[model samples]
Target: MVCINCKLFSQLNKSVDEQKQKIEDMSGLMEEMGKEEFISVFTEELFDALSKMIEEKKLSMENAILLLKRIGYLKTLKRIHYFGFEKISLSERIEKMIINEEEKKEEKNEKLLVGLCECYLLFYSRVPSSEFLSICVPCLLKAALKKEESEKAQKEVEMALLALSNIYMWTNVPKELYLSEIKEVIQYHQEHHNLTHLAYQSVWAFFTDRMFFEKSLEEVGVNELHLVREAVRELEELTKNVIWMREKKDERGKETNEELLLIRWFMTMKIYLRHCQLQNEEFVGLFNSIVQMFRAAKDNFRKISNECMYIFLVAKGNLSIEIEDLLNGGVVDVALEEMQQPTLGYKMMCYNLEIINSISWQLKGKKKDEKEEAKRKATKRKVLEKMEEKGYEDDIFCFNEILDILNEVNFYDEALSLDISDYFVNV
Candidate 1:
């Protein structure tokens, strides 16, 4: 009854529970305080809880992560830059935590490892110092490549890929060394749906960076186009899966998943359009595929409408014939319908109008290029006739309604200065 070992174990359990409770309480406290004030007051307490959790072997990694998540650590890390707290100190603690988990001889500690990596990524997103990148890149790469056949390990790998993607978003690393590692993950885990999705996102992030996009292959010292080709292949496979998922009769909560894939696919297409000049048949085929997806996706319009706006924006000035056909081919109908919905946000409504404006200006330009006045007049008549058929006049009326709403919302300056003319001109 008076055993020292048993007494010590009981005390350790109490302490662990107290730390978890403190993390839970901090969640409510965060809501009351401004971000800077919250970080200043609770940073030490949060740090101590994490440190104790790592030091004591009492709590499982899952339990520790649950506590951290309850405190909204990831969301806080996103806005870390706005605060005056000691970021370096916090980063040092997380690095130590990662290293400690890595050295553990027990089970792989996947939850704790992924949690620490999540913290690293959020911190890196705000600071992006060379010191941070040096520590983070290799650690995430190792975690991403670690092998475990368990379901828990699969979740860990997904988080690792996501963190790597976040880091790659801000920093420029040697692609030759790490791109293949990411590709290997995708190629090996192609059947693991979530893992493959994250891997493709990582690859997309790497190649779509402004530095990579702006530089030539010889200048960058890598065959990025080859990487782009590989990513396209992966994207095609993912799109097929999404289509299959859509075909299931009882599928629910698939909207978010479909949106993610569509956005990523459009992003990949934007990269290809910019770099390859939209000449590749593969890229053209993908473009057509997305157009068809948009046409067929009747119930999911709200989820994909913004992405459709961006695609139209990118297609402007690149393909005149295709642009005219798209404008006349019911895109105008889609945009008009979305704009009239009372639930639609103002920014999205603006984007919809911009798409219409771009298409209209392009069609106007094409009409001007007709040499014969009679032919020009005939083309104008045909375009107007098509617009009337597609309710373009109603869209023009809605443009004025958008202006009135903008004025009512006190965005009068934006409304007054808004230019639908020359909207097709490249910015």
Candidate 2:
């Protein structure tokens, strides 16, 4: 499992490195060509390089700007001229082009690259605006779904989709486009489960973010009620169905298969929890089930992608009542046992416990009455030390689970469903 994960991450890194090398190689060729030849060749090469960079997710906004400058494809002055403003204006040009298409096809292509470059830049910076996303996302979506689009174009579109989903929480585009694309992605996954999981991962990011619903989803008639109803139904059905293999398998094989299954279940849990939180229905029941699922998988170290799954679960819990339940459910014992094998989840749990302890200590000084405060501090210290002795201090997942216990014990205010930051991956 570790090897496979390493291999997967390595491939992602290698792909990025390859794109970086291509941009570097192309930039070197720029000064050798004559001006006219450079413009034509640069245009061709820029399209190819940026296309690959975007597809591979190796492109950053700074990189895009740097690449354009290195190749002398367009003067920064011309880009500023087209956008009619300064401060990263690629999306601005896209907005203009979409609104008024007076440019020739060649200019339009250049504008598209600029637009894509800006979109990517906005995402990497972790800040975005509605106008910027609206200008570029619709075009990218159209390009991705266009049957006549070439393979290279499609790959760029996919990269754009992934980035769009990531920063989508910051912007508000039309929901119709997002919904349509998401539905298509779901259908594609249903047919081809072994295909790349990027698209699959992106759906979660789109759904979890609050901006998507407040800005775009309502316009698209996404029917939050319908999604909630479907999620509830799906969760219940999935919870009931489990494959039991009687044939004996070695530890590694068993662990690997179980981890995969839990990951899928975790995806379902995310959907159900997000929908429940969105609808403002009672989220307790949904969260309760999620806790149960994690508990069910608790004993299986070999069969778990512990850290990532723990991150998902902890992020979902996020100071909610679910955190309390996790603690009260004997997280220390389960985590300790799981830690003997040291799954990633167990390590994360330890970190989470540490955070909670730190927070609790900081909040203690604010309390009145030194004696009462000291007593409270002592109790909190006991829990913290116990967790430490059990080898959980460094694991965030452990701290999160401890917080869950405290929540269950009614130490803090009851949880209110907060804005679901849809940036989190669903599965």
Candidate 3:
């Protein structure tokens, strides 16, 4: 069994390896070999291969479910509208399968994705009608609640919920389909173990799903506000766990799992700050605690520490003085300087520089006071140019919208409001 698992994992590894080569060729062919190109190429291969694997059924349940998630995420990156929800035939099949196998724990997940390729074919063709949006996908939830140890099943349930959320939003399907299922997914995630991140993502899906219940939420007295508060508590607990905190230790003391958890937490916290915009007292307390943790961490969390600080700045809404102090204060600059040193990890150096450059871009000033703004913009342009001359242009945003946001807000309170309000929209 273990050998078979390894072989299956190798299939994914091989696909990734092939994708890397193709990306390299594409990068060489493009005039600009930057982070955006890398992200785009990697994302395409990741999703395409995942779709293929789902068709082949070559991976284990856990791996197959992960691939399904990768598909969801890659579609998200492309800003592709109405992913799985558009596949009414496939949605009905998956739904019926769940209902049919309601009691067969190991059996249903065994071949749950056999027709996934057909679904992808229809999904990519964009011919699937909007009516697919009305399908109720929470049937998987009924299955997941019974098998608590099934991470694979739990993830699939979340994917189902996410698909329904997309369909409801994209096609303007009745809010009832979206709201009832979303609340169930949220409830399931809150009660389930090892499903925190999925729950966090669902919160965003619900809020952005058909503008969520903007008018309905107010009238129905459904308080997503409290859910946001609960999520904050969950994240704080995850971050502070001993396993996760081990990343704060030095090289010899740090473990890979701990480091990985830190990376995950960084992403989770970012998602929270990005979507929830929950302004409750619990959220405020958790946010401050995270900032303090960032201040006290050791060098092992170097790259992740920068990410956390970036999130902190974004969350606090004080990019003006707060970001300025952090970046210029030698914390980020010195760490970045050390990574770039010849004796350090060269690839690591490249990666670190990319992250730091993005942070710097976020921190760049964009005052409307012409003389001062011009001076700041020129300085920023010079800095970016210098970095680009050194062969790094991955953090380049086509527009200055990010800088504009930082300039507009000066504290976490303001930043949180910005996210929830749809003011300063990404689109």
By summed lDDT, the worst window of 10 consecutive residues in model 1 runs over: 1-10
TM-score of each: 0.57, 0.39, 0.42
Task: State the lDDT of candidate 2 residue by residue for 1-427, as single tens digits.
Answer: 3342232222323344564565566544443333344333423333444445545666654455445434322221011112212233443433454445323554466445544443443223334455555645565555445333455555454454554444534455556546666556555544544223333344444555544345444322234323333333444554454433332244323222233334544543454343432332334344444445555544544233343335334433443223333344444344444444443443443433333443343434434888756755665555566556765544434334344444444322233112121111110
Best by TM-score: 1
lDDT (0 to 1) per candidate: 0.52, 0.42, 0.42
| Candidate 1 ranges beyond 4 A from true positions | 1-48, 52-89, 96-118, 145-153, 186-196, 210-333, 336-345, 363-386, 397-427
Clashing pairs in model 3, backbone N/Cα/C closer than 3 A: 316-411, 316-412, 317-410, 317-411, 317-412, 318-410, 318-411
RMSD of each: 9.3, 15.3, 14.5
Write candidate 1's Cα lDDT for 260-376 as tens digits: 656656665555444443233333444454555555553445455456556655655355235434444455556656665667676666656665665555556444344644554
Question: Model 2 — which ten-residue stretch has the worst lDDT?
Answer: 418-427
List the candidate 2 regions with Cα displacement exceeding 4 Å.
Answer: 1-126, 147-154, 166-168, 174-177, 192-195, 210-306, 309-334, 338-349, 352-427
Off by over 4 Å in 3: 1-129, 136-174, 188-225, 240-279, 296-298, 316-427
Candidate 3, lDDT over the whole model: 0.42
CA shift at 191, candidate 1, in angstroms?
A: 9.0
